[model samples]
Structure formats: C-alpha cells, structure tokens
Target: MKTLLNVLLRLIETARILGLNYRDLKNAEDLLMHNEFGLCFDTIITQMYEYEIEIDDELYESISKIGDIMNLKPESYTFMKELIRDESNIPKPLKDELTRIITSLIE
Candidate 1:
C-alpha cells in the first residue's frame, strides 16, 4: 500500500509537471493500462533534460530509499545513473540541484 501510494503520487506529480490538470487523469485506469511503468521516471529525466525543477526532499528520499531497499539490479541502477548524469542542457542552478540530489543518492 505504501509503495502504491508513492507510485500514485509520482504519477500525479508527473502529470502536473506535464502541464496537465485533474481532468487529464479522469480516465487514468484505461490510460495507464497501455503505458510503460518506467515512463514516469523517463518523464522526470526528460523534464530534467529540458529544464530542472525542484523535487521535494520527501519525494527524493522516497525514491532513494525505495531504490536502496530494493537493491535494484545493475541495469536499473545504471539507467538511473545515466538519467541523473545527463546534465547536457540544464541550467547551472538546476544542474547544481541535480548534482546535489545525485550526490545524496551516491552516499
């Protein structure tokens, strides 16, 4: 239940970042039935590529804790490492923010 709640929160946050309103999730069940679960993280990565935004500490900690508890596979870990390290076009402040977040995860 806790995991589900976290995933749902991430889904809602993703929609919000995509400039979506509540109505966008009105048909969520059907909509999500056809989408990849990993797309949520991919969306975050893509958004980071375009522009950085604050990720609340709680949310970041939730993600990091989940990853740590799960002992995520090497491939998944590599994927995350790649996503966070992709600072190609981000502004300095956002880049620094990402660096901090990634660094936290590293430790």
Candidate 2:
C-alpha cells in the first residue's frame, strides 16, 4: 500500500519534472511540514492540474499510485477527462490510465 511519504516523494518528483523548485510549492511544503498530509496532498494535486504540466507514462502511473493513497478531488476527474478526450494530444497508455482512474472513482 502506498504511504503518505510515497505521495510526498511523488510530488517532489513532479516538481522536478516540471522544472519547479521545491520552494515554489511553498504552501504545500509548509502544510506537509506541519503534518497536514491531506491538505498537502490536495494542494499539490490542485497545483499540478492548474499548471497543466506535461505528463509521461511513468509520472502518470506514479500519480495514480499517489491517488490511491488519498481520495482524489472531483476536479481530478474533470481534468483527467479533458486529457482523455484529447486523443491527438495524449498517448494511448496515459488515456487508459485516466480511464481506469475515472472508472474507479465512479465505482
């Protein structure tokens, strides 16, 4: 089972991939430092969606695992749906992953 630490590590990985410094996610970092795991997770997830950073297959899988550790916000579905619908832009595997997440959310 994925843990909160795994989620935090994934978030840091995402920040690096996005070329964002760890300090840039100050709110999430502070929340995490304060042991506010849920809030920190939510903040990082929201920031990622809002940033619309490019996601590869590996990162998508990592995010899926992180999502399993915490209930994803409804916004995640909307954002993922947008990605899945953009067939020209998203890879098949990534779309499949998003579909899996959406199906799980509804179940």
Candidate 3:
C-alpha cells in the first residue's frame, strides 16, 4: 500500500482546505494500520462528497500511478467502480462509526 502513503500526504492538504479537527490524524494512522487502501479511499471520498467538497485530482492521480507501478490488485479499482455506480454512497464498513467509537473511548 505504498500508494496509500501518497494518498495520506494529500489528505493532509485536504484537511487544511477543509479546516478539519485533529481526528483526521488518528484516522490516517488507523488507515495505515488497517492497510485498507480501497476502503479508506472510499471513506475519504465519501466524506468529501458529503461535505460537498471537490476531490483532489492530482492526489488521486498520484495514488493511481503508484498502484500501477506496484501492480496493486484490482480490489480498490473494483470498489471504486461500485462506488461510481452507486453514486458515491458510503459503504457500510466505511461509515463514520469509528469517530463515535473513538470519541467514546476517549471520553
């Protein structure tokens, strides 16, 4: 998931643009630990969609290039297609439940 690192770096820019809280930092770590590039990319995309923000094309391109160089499996691409067909609906696993879970744990 080397490409995921590229995506994460770009996500920092996205966070700045959106002025999000520090939770994004924790989310980034969780994504890395999980090694779930597709799932987490979908989550990021879905969150941007919900917030009516534009996706960063350059970051996306960087991720795609890395995936190609590393010959990543088709899993992420396949999921992306499904998200497109479903009109960017956030899948169940990518829901915001973690934020609540983490919040509760911290509290």
Local accuracy of candidate 2 as per-residue lDDT tens digits, 1-107: 24686668667666667755466578777787787777776676666655555555556666666666567655553453332234366655567889999999999
Off by over 4 Å in 2: 21-24, 71-107
Give the whole-model CA lDDT for all candidates, comma-separated.
0.48, 0.63, 0.53
Q: For residues 32-77, could you state the per-residue lDDT of candidate 3 as single tens digits?
A: 5687655455555445444444334454565455456546665553
Full-model lDDT, candidate 1: 0.48
Candidate 3 worst ten-residue window by lDDT: 77-86
How much is the lDDT of residue 70 in candidate 2? 67
Which candidate do you rate higher for TM-score, 2 or 3? 2
Better of 1 and 2 by lDDT: 2
Q: What stretches of model 3 exceed 4 Å from their correct place?
A: 55-107
Better structure of 1 and 2 per TM-score: 2
Q: Give, for candidate 1, the lowest lDDT window spanning 10 residues.
A: 77-86
Model 2, position 2, has a per-residue lDDT of 41
Give the RMSD in angstroms, all C-alphas superposed, for model 2: 12.1
Highest lDDT, which number?
2
